[model samples]
Target: MKSFIILPALASLATAHYDLVFPEWRGDSFADGASQWIYPCANVTQEKSNRTLWPLDGGAVNIHMHHHWTYYAINIGIGTLEPAFTATLTPELHNTTGNGTLCIPKLSVPAGLAKEGDNATLQVVTFDSFGSALYNCADITFSSKAVDPTDCKTDGVKDVIVGAEAAKTSTDTANTTDAAPTPSQSTGGAAASFGGAGAGVVAAVAVGLALMI
Candidate 1:
């Protein structure tokens, strides 16, 4: 019985929930909140629901502003940083930071999050605790392994590969999709061919075909 219980206990410790949140972030600029640090604390639950909030281990989050931005990071849920996890953003480049912020200037509901209601990033981290990132002097140098961190806390690390890729890909797809044809812009005769009359007639024909198909 003792042996049987050991594996289960270890497994449970091996996995923990991570949740993070900034505030409502009431403005269109990062500068509005740049002076104050928003201390994030996890609001955690094993319960499954649209409104379950996970707790962060630290009593209240400690954040600061450096350079041109205010930054915050929370474990969201606990997990090993031995191998970092990945989260994606649609129509944007992969963030490559474990510390995520809402990016007030480019705020939008994260693609599939509409059913859940409001969302935000709250902080920006472009590198890992090990120091490998799109931007930075690094918290730690990536070598055989980075089991600890010096400059930055190592709750865990995250890669924005998926989010960034989705953002860009979605944008590209949208640009190509549902576009109005510019055949009218192609030739010197474009004015004679399309800029003349019947442009509405052409649009109507296109719509009719789309509906039929």
Candidate 2:
């Protein structure tokens, strides 16, 4: 009976969604704030520094989702600026359901923006068919030397391919889904809710610790 009970609980976690797990969290992120939903890099305190050097050329990030989602994006901001770079995440299996994992096999650093010891923020966000959205922020430092992602092992993490394949110049409304419906960029406008930020470039991350019921 104990085995049966434990198994179902684990299964529930496997399917229950809503969390962001990667790129490491900024100071007190997503803490008691609704506006952080709109401002990906909101309320960040760069008060502490991390010695971990993220390779600019070939760094890989991991994401785990309780259920499948329609849209995933990665946005980057340097220093005190708004996000300037956006990329969409494409899973090898599009339009999936149930619990799954997505991985960013590699990260592309913007030219001339990231040098050794530069501070930047990466936002990993996602949207569901219900138009509800989830997001998180990571504070990172640029490494001068390129690192090989092959050395980085995320055993349980799936590789979510990142690129500009689904990117659009405008965050305006458009249907770009392969099968599942795509989320709208505007707030309360369509299938997906981006909190008035629109559906531009963003990334999705799921952390088991921050699961939302």
Candidate 3:
């Protein structure tokens, strides 16, 4: 009887997932859980009919998370056909908790990697507490206009620094006289790094549950 009850609870937890809230998703990832682990753009073979106009200087990335805690890595690729995702937008792995809208206000494109009128794709990789890597993408065309600041607001969320970052923060606090800033004060927004092109492979980990749309 206990085993039967535990099975359903585990199933519900596995089904809870996230989606790209800003820009636009390539396809309906929520249709299946297995497809979310497909590399590049969650097995999204073709580009979307409409492309979002992203700011040339930098832009916002918003995602609605369902996990209580998750780690994120953002990347970008330039092109319309089989674009190489050589640019990593997040400097380091960012961990956050509470499960709601998580927004990175401004993520600048790597220097000289892209320019006005160029087409590109934004990829977001998330590692959930269950040790599963979830993938999602957004198609965009670079423009001079900026995304609305209001679009980057967060709700019921908190940034968490773990491992080496936690150690460094502890040491810094000991040496400083000022009070440490809260997690809400420093959200996840960092400069991007553009390296050479490489094939971005998606991990095929089986999590037997459907993704929430």
Candidate 4:
């Protein structure tokens, strides 16, 4: 019989990958293309003004990375309703003109930015423009691998019990089935995603199972 325990075991192991997604909008002229993506994050809020002089418009880039090398997906600019407001990563600087670059002080898309511990602030930016300088705000989300990970918790005792029972039921049915058995695996990866709370729930289930044995 395949190792049934393997399913939960797969929970802990880590993987790595990268992705980039951004919303675009119609451009000013025909040549400027259909649209542009301003920030790469889902909901990016930028407030550019004086007082902060790190990069364009005193904007900041906050990266809250964690364990393992994380690949980030960034949204340059979501679609815009305004005609003149073209949101996209531009190479423009402050006090300049001409259809500036979408991303400000555009940083070279890092060749595989890694590590949860890795941190940086994007206060000031500099990118090549036709003539002037502008501000920029880029949004990003990271993961260890390309496949999207679920943000589900281990649930609770009820959920875990339901899952365990469901797992056992599926196994027992396959045993008598005419079709060949594929295999069994652990519930690591996603299980661990339950954050810190998952550990407790899994431990409880294990203890409860031991009693039954």
In candidate 3, what are the lDDT values of residues 39-99, reduced to their tens digit? 7567765644357889987688888888787667777888876577776777544677887
- For residues 1-213, could you state the per-residue lDDT of candidate 1 as single tens digits? 898989986663322211223221212223333222221211211132122121221112222222121112221211212112122222232222333322222223233322222222222232222222111100111122212112333233333432334345444555688753343323323333333434553443222212111
- RMSD of candidates 1 onward, in order: 21.4, 11.1, 9.2, 23.2
Tens-digit lDDT track for model 2 on 108-170? 665565677666666665554334445556666677664544433344433332222233322
Where model 2 places Cα greater than 4 Å from the true spot, the runs are 1-20, 27-38, 41-52, 80-98, 145-213
Residue 68 of model 3, lDDT score = 82
Give candidate 3 regions above 4 Å deviation: 1-13, 32-34, 129-131, 161-165, 176-213
Model 4, 1-213: lDDT tens digits are 356677554442211111111111111211232111222111233232111122222222222211132111222322222112222222221121222122222233233332332222221222121111112233222323322212322111110222344445555666668544344422432333333343544443322222110
User: Which model scores highest in TM-score?
Assistant: 3
Please give the lDDT score for candidate 3. 0.67
Sorted on lDDT, best first, the list reads 3, 2, 1, 4
Q: Weakest 10 consecutive residues, lDDT, candidate 1?
A: 133-142
Q: Judge candidate 2 against the unseen true structure and give its global Cα lDDT, from 0 to 1.
A: 0.47
Candidate 4, TM-score vs. the true structure? 0.18
